[model samples]
Target: MLLTERLMAGERVFSAWSSVPDSLNAEGLAATPFDAVCLDMQHGAHHEDSVMRCLGPIIASGKPGLVRVPVDRFDMAARALDFGAQAVIAPMVNSVADARAFAQSMKYPPVGKRSWGPHLAMGRSGFSGPQSAWLDEANRKTLAFAMIETREALDAVDEILAVAGIDGVFVGPSDFSIALTDGKAVDPSLESMMEAIAHISARAQAVGKHAGIYVVDPKLVQRYSAMGYRLFALGNEQNYMERGAAALLADAGALTS
Candidate 1:
């Protein structure tokens, strides 16, 4: 099913956000029950080559592959979609213009100026019938999310959400905390910060758009889930590995050594 369809159905999407630029790691994570596997390129160690390498395993595992591009590179955004990404997570979208551009890049003409070239997306989407119809179908199905991380974005939340073709918004909690506190420690638990996050979600819902958040802590997942967050990024591969290793070592009595 299309990610947007699932989101619109009120399904809670738990995504595995990957920082490690290894196809092996992506394959393993994709094999899990997580709804999606998003390869982080903005801050994580991923470039075009690594993303191409990682896409194969993600596709093979039968999980949707998402790419958080470095910036509002429409060409790269379009390329990522062509390369079989089910969605494009554009970061640092602090204005309506940014959101519009990102959304445009993800869509085709009339909706946006995404050039016609779906080498991988064509086969991956399983539509070998007709190009024109497939383009329309792809335009409707492919998701595009703008990262609401800056104070400017928070101020213009409604306008950004109003932009056509933007499926939803993702909250970058750490950056949001910093933006809220003006360079203070990143604290998602601060009353003011929590209120701001909740306000973002509430505003999105008011306009029929979905709201999501990047959260590593399970407790934060529960907290945000209660606050009506439909999308949750459950940390990265390294974080999972460290947590699992720590638990195993502690259980084996190796931590006391």
Candidate 2:
């Protein structure tokens, strides 16, 4: 099923994404956690080959597999789908035009301009013949998510959500912190920022679309979820590993002593 469907079904998704270069670790990490795991090709060192490997366990886990392409390029998005990525989170989409281009690239001609072929998605080397009929279904099944990071995007939240094929909007406040936060933990600016995010999220809900956020700490993560964030990217991959490893060691040491 599409990740959006899972989210709309009221699934509180926990996506364990891989930040390191190794796809095996990415795949392994996804197999053990939440509903789905994203192989982060945008910020991580995970190349095409490694990413394919990382997807192994995620798909094996019976959970959906997601790929966060590093940039806003159609080629990257297209490549991700070719590798059997069930969905893609395109980083830094700031406008309605940008969203439309992404949708076109993601879908077939009628719905999108994505070139027809079953690269790795269907175990085919490539397009050996014309496949006009199947492209729409293929495009319809895959998901597209836009990152809401820029102040400009904040103003265009409603329009972005209104884009026909866009599945979800993820608030990336760490990168666009000012618009989403006034100061630090208790900054007054946070109230307005929070309100804005809540507004966008609410608008999304009103339209039957998903609202989401990428938060660093556990408290904030849960906080946003409680406020109705259905699809949340918990945090960066490195932080997850470091804290987990340290906690494991500390626990082991305490147990031994």
Q: What is the clash count for each candidate, in the order shown?
A: 0, 5
In candidate 1, the residue pairs with backbone N, CA or C atoms under 3 Å apart (3 or more residues apart, or in different chains) clash, namely none
lDDT of 1: 0.85
lDDT of 2 by residue, 95-199 (tens): 999899887777766667777655566652233444554463676667888888767788888898888778778876665665444434433225457767777
Best-fitting candidate, scored by lDDT: 1
- What's the C-alpha lDDT at position 130 in model 1? 80
How does each model score on lDDT? 0.85, 0.72
lDDT for predicted candidate 2 compared with the true structure:
0.72
Model 2 clash pairs are 23-54, 42-70, 108-112, 182-189, 182-190
RMSD of each: 1.5, 3.9
What RMSD does model 2 have? 3.9
